[model samples]
Target: MSTSLKIYDTTLRDGTQGEGISFSVTDKLLIAQKLDQFGVDYIEGGFPGSNPRDISFFAEAKKLKLTHAKLAAFGATRRAGVKPEEDAQLRTLIESEMPVLTIVGKTWLMHVHEILRTTPEENLAMIEDSVRYLVAQGREVIYDAEHFFDGYLDNSDYALRTLEAAARGGASNLTLCETNGGKLVPEVHKIAAAAVARFGRDKVGVHCHNDSGLGVAVTLAGVDAGASLVQGTMNGYGERVGNANLVTLLPNLFLKMGRTANCAKNLKELRDLSLFFDELANLRPNPKAPFVGQSAFAHKGGLHANAAQKVARSYEHIDPALVGNRTRVLVSDMAGRTSLTLKARELGIELDERLPAMKGLIDELKEREFRGYEYEAADASFRLLIAKWLGQQKTFFDVENYRVIIERHNNQIWSEATVKLTVNGEAMHTVAEASGPVGALDKALRLALAKAYPQLQTMSLRDYKVRILESNQGAGSRTRVLIESGNGKKIWGTVGVSDNIIDASWEALRDSVEYMLMQS
Candidate 1:
């Protein structure tokens, strides 16, 4: 039978230590519920004594009815000479009323001597005293031997004694922490194996960081070395270079390593879980992240796309569906007929590569891209192009002409635009004013179509990006504009390029409206 591993998530505690990561009490509560739903074994709430946000989170979290994950509170072991019962931090931990308590204690003799200003034996006593007191209070104490790997290298005997002390004091698990995050995979495997032999497999856990860029590797190595518990943060968020990524580690443990975890059965929710964290963090998801990334299973090259079209395994490692992700065929200038065919199929469009129109479309795509059109980032534009080539594109409206004027008077500037278009063979002219030329144009255009297409009212421009194609040309440089629009339901991207910035913006804005109408 595969060894059942305990997945101890420190995302709420340690993950908040990462730069640019901050969560409100409600955010913490929501994430805890999500982790429980995802089937993680433990959720480490933050240090209650550190900040009111964490204290508030613990208070609110106690009311949350988490289904699977046991709520764990994180803190350091009682101070150098302080008794556990008298320690304010320890008292706060107990007041938080969490069932599982993880207390990090100094494992390195240098920390004991220099940092704690205490003797090696005194540090051992502190670890024992803290763990014993917590256990006596009916808490399942998990002792985090901070800097265990580095301390073990410094003085193996003293490090082994630290674990023995925690064990004697009733620590349910002895977690060997690679605090510096600089330990190699081999070193972690060897040290973790030795610790497991000394303290039994079920009693030893591993916590690693990613300073060496091997947090995931070393974590897997620890598991390989018979550690039964794994501790890390989701999305690799932590202090410094971050902790071993449970987002990356969970799949490795359950799928690649054939290990059983409480979360193993909910493996299909992996991508959603990763995305959920990114969304809450307000950080753009890493497109290149393994397993759950947008580009993880995206095929771009012609040959690669062709092979993937014939046999998915030719380009993909495992079935993306296993992790709730799907393969994407990116359409680019380098795309072959097979690539276009696959891309078309992905978009729910029927395009037979053997058709003569396929060759023309490919040639046109290359020519357009050579002229600074990027289809990959503009899916809506690409779909429109396919429709035009296939003679299936609808002509909802036709623009006769558009004019934009900017005026600066009395230190105030304003832009006005006039648009003339025909909707269903009826001439329509509209004029509007805004703060910028693009904004003016958008207002005028929408005014012209408001009555004809009320659906465009909910659709508004969400984002606009402009890139100069040729910097050397300076004032005469060709500009590419990308616009993202949302109709309160789905979002789509469109692109346009021209020598004039206004022209480029107009092209993108027009395409955005056309794409929305086409869909409607």
Candidate 2:
């Protein structure tokens, strides 16, 4: 029988520390419940004494009747001079009443002397007293030996003494941490093997960081060397370069190694789990992340797509459905007849082999791509391209003419935009004034379209990103604008490119309205 590994998730605690990520108490509770449903062994909610939100999250998590996972409250070990029983932080950690408690203690001599301004012996005493106090309070304590890898390399005897203190203090587990995240795979294996040899396998754990981009590799090396518990955050959110990403590590442990880890929850739900957090955090999901990314299974080369169609194992490592992703054949200039036919079939469009329109559309896409229009990132434009080629697109209104006026008056700027549009053979004109040219144009366009398409009023731009394509200097700098719009249930992205920002924004806005109408 394969041994089941423990999955310790720190998304609530460490993930929120990621730059620009903040979660409310309710958000923390939701993530905790979802992680429970996903079969994680433990959920580290947050450090209770660190912030008011975290303190509230601990109180809120206590009220939840979690079915499978144990909630862990996190905090630092006691101060150098104070006893664990006397330290307010340690007392607060106990008062949180979580079933599990994780306390980080200094392991590196540099941190002891420089950061903590304490003697090495005092640091060891803090670890010992904190673990004993938490354990004595009926809490399962996991002592995180912060900077254990570096500490071991610096002074093997002192690092070993720290682990011995936690063990002697009845800590349920001693987690070796890579604080700076610079340890290579070989160094990880060597240190982990030595720690296991000294502490025995059951008492050891691994907490990795990603500063050097080796978190995942180092984590795997730790497990291979004999770690019973692996600690990391989902999507690798943390202070600096982020913590180790367990989303990438779990599948490698369970699927690749064929080790049983009790992850009976739908492994296919990994993608949704990843994206759900991204949405809540108001961040764009990384498209290149392994297993759950948008392009994880996307195939583009003609030879690769043909091989993938024949036997997915030829080009793909495994079936994407195993992780709840579908194989995609991107339509681009490199797409051959086989790739095009597959794309059409997936879209429910039947194309005759000899259709001139099909070839013409492919040629147009190639020509446009060379001119700075990227269809891959702009699915709205790609869909419109297909609809136009099929003669199935409907234009609710035609824009006859538009002009933007910018004037400088008395050391201030004034802007006005006017749009003349024809809707169903009736002409309408609207004018709007704003602080800037782009805002004025948006107001005018919305006012003109609102009369005809009432649904357009419900839709708004959620995000707008601009990128310059060619940087050949002032006169000929080609620019592209990617606009993301939402109508609550679905999000659509459109792209527009031109020398003028107003023109690009107008093109993207026009596509947005058209896409919404198609949805309706």
Candidate 3:
């Protein structure tokens, strides 16, 4: 029977090392579970002995029954002249009781001589001794030859000797690392082919980094050259450019290359997984990442949208459903009638080609987008604009007048806001004081809306972003405020621009409430 390629993920170990990325113990476990659902063969948790959070992750992860993947602990090989049994880090790896352990060892002669400050003979001994000790302790060891490709190119004999040490030491597998990740495809093919020839295909693995932007290509070369195990990170997280993104690489290999049996995962889930990590990290998802990014299947141009509407494959490289991503027909100034018709159908609104309202709405959308009001990002507000254009939106309430009073006390600013509103044919007035003008206005607006729509009491603003359209003019400059509000079930965003920041905030706040009320 043919075997599938083994996917080893190091997102928790290597991904967390990425600049500006730090995962709590709980975050690691959540990501681990997501990888398991992605059909990974192994999940490499961080080095158990290096940090308390990682140690806690290992302890907690082992208690959960993972369905598809085995959790692995990562660490360096034992120190020179020290037995693995006596090494505290190695002992910690064993205590984690994970089914697999990966220990990296020196392969490049330069590293052996300079970084390790040891003779080649001692480096080989370290490799052999470390693997043997781990195997003796009943742990399955994968010996990673750091910088193996560069080492193989510089000194073929020494590189082969390092592998021989691991083979003789009872290592279950030996992985070649492109540690600097500067290698090209031809070089990776050459080295991986030679390693497979020397070590036998079953005993070899590939660990690639993305510094040169060729990590995925190099990994594919290694696989083609008969490396059975591919090690990388989810979303390509790591130091510098990052490791090979297995999320993208896997689908490419499975669907495009036909190398492995379909893992039965909904490819669209990859998007959710990527966004889940971004949310956990409090970072925005990349809009252009392959397979799962926001723009992966988004079409904006008229010709492209028209072509995609007729034959999606003409514009899309692959079916979006293959990776759990949906094609988004973005309506912009460039969008044509085909794009608008498709979007209307998606929104469950009938498309009437001769309707002047439809054409007017498209024109209005283009005009607003020209001023930096991005309907793509402010989707809820865009929906309201669409509904109003169609004469289908209901007016929840009307604002008669509103005023904000700013007072200076002890060199500090205070704001008192008052609003007069008509709700369901009745007029009501309310006043609220807050730390700032916008805060006070928002407080007063919410209080007034709550009287009519009781559900407004549960809503909260989750994120607020402000951008200065032109900053050269300083405090008097016109700025844009983008507000994202959520009520647990749904999220809506709106944008407002003005010279007065308070007015911009009020506009955004009013649009947010109006969008929510329209949804209700």
Candidate 4:
């Protein structure tokens, strides 16, 4: 068998099926180009003629000059009884001018009869005619035998017939889909081998869902059975649980399974690509998600940190740097000096391992922990604190006084804020308005220092999160604020804890600005 495998990505199409996952036309085009950069074989542009957004996305996507990855327009076979050429969906697929058109057709007889409202033979005819029509139109077709696993389990002979029909119609590939994601690895192994026996090994593909949390396992098992194409989405964003997570799957296939694919040559971009898509969709990157997640290579336990520092593979599966991620030693209750030193080293802190100050730092961290401050999720703040302790930190400006006024009038809420600050003994005051006191205060602070730092033009607050810490004095409870700031090229999180939410936000906001300046 050839070691080469074809990687088909459905992030733009099937990925949007995931709840709260959406991409604008521009976002779709950018992702397509990134996918091309990542060296995937194909990127499905979504089902054209189904919605205005998809239609617009295909138009813009076709304009991008991709280096790798074929642009594929997705659609179903012609309606129950219609010519593929005259059908609007198929016609739109052709008009999109994508290099390929991926068409799904009924495979399970139950779907053919019940959902499609057509006889089993008619459904077969639809598959054959649609693939043939697209082929005749000079478009490469990948026939998706949707529900193939379930269909094969219910009616093996009929499911095999569907693949044969698509093959006769000139489909370049026949993909077996675990539609409901209910198939286990053993079932995938068995059914995929049968698919190869019936349709030959050259063109069989595997597409799976994550309902059973075994999408990647099942896909690998199918590959073991000689299926050459792996269909999935980045981070497994799809309907229900999700599609197989390409973030985890691709690295495994290349490093462990030794499967040759385009992306294998560019493993370094894997983590960046995964986070890029998540940020674009305004979704929080899953901390516990497989290979590309934040926690993938994070070590918290003292023993694990010690062993990992000496020999990384002791606690890590691979050198995280190979995938554009680094081993992160987290500071937690289970952490020791090793963890602190590892984390401090990341921020360029050169605290001596044997120094007595090491224990003092640890004590300080524990005291802060008791004060409702968490550093695990806010490294930027931790770094700033470390810099301050080492006397390496700089203060560009000092806040002397700040006030915010919020009131309701004319049935609309209004807020204004003022800040008094000093830079190098010179005093300055600025005022601004926003929908909320935090925004107004942030604006006021920035306006005050706008003249001192112009690079601030490139940065913006990405997200703001607030949580109330439990206290015996309920009315005087303290709050913790976490602010995510991004400079278009990178993002960092800072933390603040105080009795007043405004004070907490200001602390985080100040740290965020200081962190960015320190980098600049």
How many collisions per candidate?
0, 0, 5, 0
Worst 10 residues of 2 by lDDT: 257-266
Whole-structure CA lDDT of model 1: 0.92
152: Cα error in model 2, Å: 1.7
Expressed as tens digits, the lDDT of each residue in 132-192 for candidate 2 is 8899999999989999999999999999999999999999999999989999999999999
Candidate ranking under TM-score, highest first, comes to 1, 3, 2, 4
Which of the two, 1 or 4, has more lDDT?
Answer: 1
Question: What is the lDDT for 110 in model 1?
Answer: 90
Q: Pick the candidate with the highest TM-score.
A: 1
- Between candidates 1 and 4, the one scoring higher on TM-score is 1
- Global lDDT of each candidate: 0.92, 0.86, 0.85, 0.89
Off by over 4 Å in 2: 80-82, 110-125, 352-354, 407-415, 433-443, 449-452
Q: What is candidate 3's CA lDDT for residue 162?
A: 96
Candidate 1 lDDT over 152-267, as tens digits, reads 99999999999999999999999999999999989999999999999999999999999999999999999999999999998999999899999889888887888998888888
Superposition error at 147 for model 1 (Å) = 1.3
Q: TM-scores across all candidates?
A: 0.96, 0.90, 0.93, 0.88
Predicted candidate 1: what Cα RMSD to the true structure?
Answer: 1.7
* Model 4 C-alpha lDDT per residue in residues 304-420, reported as the tens digit of each score: 998999988889999888888888888866667888888888777767778766676778887887888888878898888777666678988888999999989989887899999
Clashing pairs in 2: none
Instruction: Give candidate 2's whole-model lDDT.
Output: 0.86
